[model samples]
Target chain A: MIKKIFSLIIIAGLLTVFIPIILNFSFQTDLPDVAKSYVEKGSKDLGAMNIVTAIIVTFRGLDTLGEVAVLFIAATGIAVLFRKNAINDKRPKQISKRDSSEILLTGIRLLAPVILIFGIYIFLNGHLSPGGGFQGGAVIATVVLLLFLSDSSYKINHKIFGFIESFSGVSYVIIGFLGLVLMGADNFLDNRILPLGEFGTILSAGAIPIIYTLVGLKVGTELASVLDNMKGDIE
Target chain B: MTDVFIIVLGLVMIVFAILALYLKDLVASVIAAGVLSLFASILYLIMQAPDVAMTEAAIGAGLLTMIFLLAIKKTKQIEDPND
Candidate 1:
């Protein structure tokens, strides 16, 4: 009875909220003033075909940096929470390669490389395409998750993980620091330092793609590490 | 026409969300949540926000579901409705 009542109330609330969206009449079609200027000027100023990437990696770089820091903190927290259990356990529990079907293994071998290439392509073309660092990085993390799903005992090298994770984080800051030094502290994360090649290309967008690539590596490694710890805790 | 598709997808999302809440098995609930994310991503795509759709599909459906499943593996594999 309580479940029925609760569900009914929730459904009613959702319907009320979604009615406008369902009608599609309340959806704003015109771009706001700030967004209008961004779309108009962003392509020429930032040399990024994807104005969203320009907004995220250039205009709001400090915000993106802060966001990445928040993600890093969350990753650190998860690591710390599961640290003891992860360390004490030397071996993976109840996992056997033989337990998985041969077909799955064959599929993984054939599909893993494609997924990886796709993820790299997503990040590499972030300036010109819909994908950016966070999206691509998450896609890359899926590769590790896929491996874990197939074989719980799949081991990722801690050394490589740590290197990729830390290097990306440090390089992000280093690039920002370069901006501060070269273009003044107020200009931290400015994209004008490097040559902004042709627009709508992989090599364009100055530092946006580089920053996004670093962001992807950091996010991907961080998530993979978190998943690793959780997998460790499972008996 | 697009509205019809949007409404249908939205309904599917709500249904999956309800199924997630109603399910007894923790893993099933997590899978339901993944399906919900998938629908949400499709909605984003239909709305022309491809970046958001990609992120939702990858992180929401893929990464989060795996995390939840691992958490379920670590904790109670099954939920007890009775206190």
Candidate 2:
């Protein structure tokens, strides 16, 4: 059944790719004039050097909220599956007992902090630059993965991770609601409610940077925790 | 320069994608698929679409590869091509 499904998918994908070429569909080269004008105007207003960041944080903030919720749901699903099997299964025995080279491990230790700092920097400047919460969070998790591989004994503090994950997730929503009351906005994540500081400043983009930072923290911590927890099971 | 790089990168990505599809070992195939995604990101950069490139790198190379590796660990390896 799986192989048949894969074959059908391949056939459908090939048909779509080939049919588009055979029919010669003309793709639009430019955005609508109204959208282009608004983009030009909004780029400056939003204080984002990267137009994509502006669209993500401001124009499409609600979609981002949904994406984060999806992440939370996935994490919960994994948690549920593991919790049910936790008591029945013994912790996986560590495989490949070969010791890592001290030099390689040292290099990883040195690099981990730099990667984490870079992720944080990206999250903090998300409103002003190209990087944002999701990217930064992934980067941070990459650092954790590096640590896990280079040092098998490395373990995450589950309590700290749980606290950080929950706090960041809750704070993200709270920040949005705060925007309603503090800025007297009618909606949850209205940027017009927050003080849009001087253009191009780190403090600019109203509540966007703060929100992204929270998202970054939540994602990074949760992903790292997931990967860390998987360590005991991959044997 | 960019156009030439893009053309070459696209070719490389296509090649890797084919390898990923045809390879016998599931783990190797997954890794090859990830390399294909990395090449796709390079093509995107050559085409001046960093945002898409970033997404491709993250979702395709990072997340997808990790998921495949986990799934492969859970399932029994295929012994015969038919089996």
Top candidate on lDDT is 1
In model 2, which residue pairs have backbone atoms overlapping below 3 Å? none
Per candidate, native contacts kept equal 0.87, 0.13
Highest TM-score against the true fold, candidate: 1
Candidate 1's C-alpha runs over 4 A off are A1-25, A85-98
TM-score of each: 0.87, 0.85
iRMS per model in Å: 0.8, 2.3
Best by DockQ: 1
Poorly placed runs, candidate 2 (over 4 Å): A1-22, A84-96, B1-4, B74-79
Residue B42 C-alpha lDDT in model 1: 89
| TM-score, chain A, candidate 1 | 0.83
Worst 10 residues of 1 chain A by lDDT: A90-99
The predictions' CA RMSDs to the true structure, in order, are: 3.4, 3.3
lDDT for residue A107 in candidate 2, whole number 0-100: 100
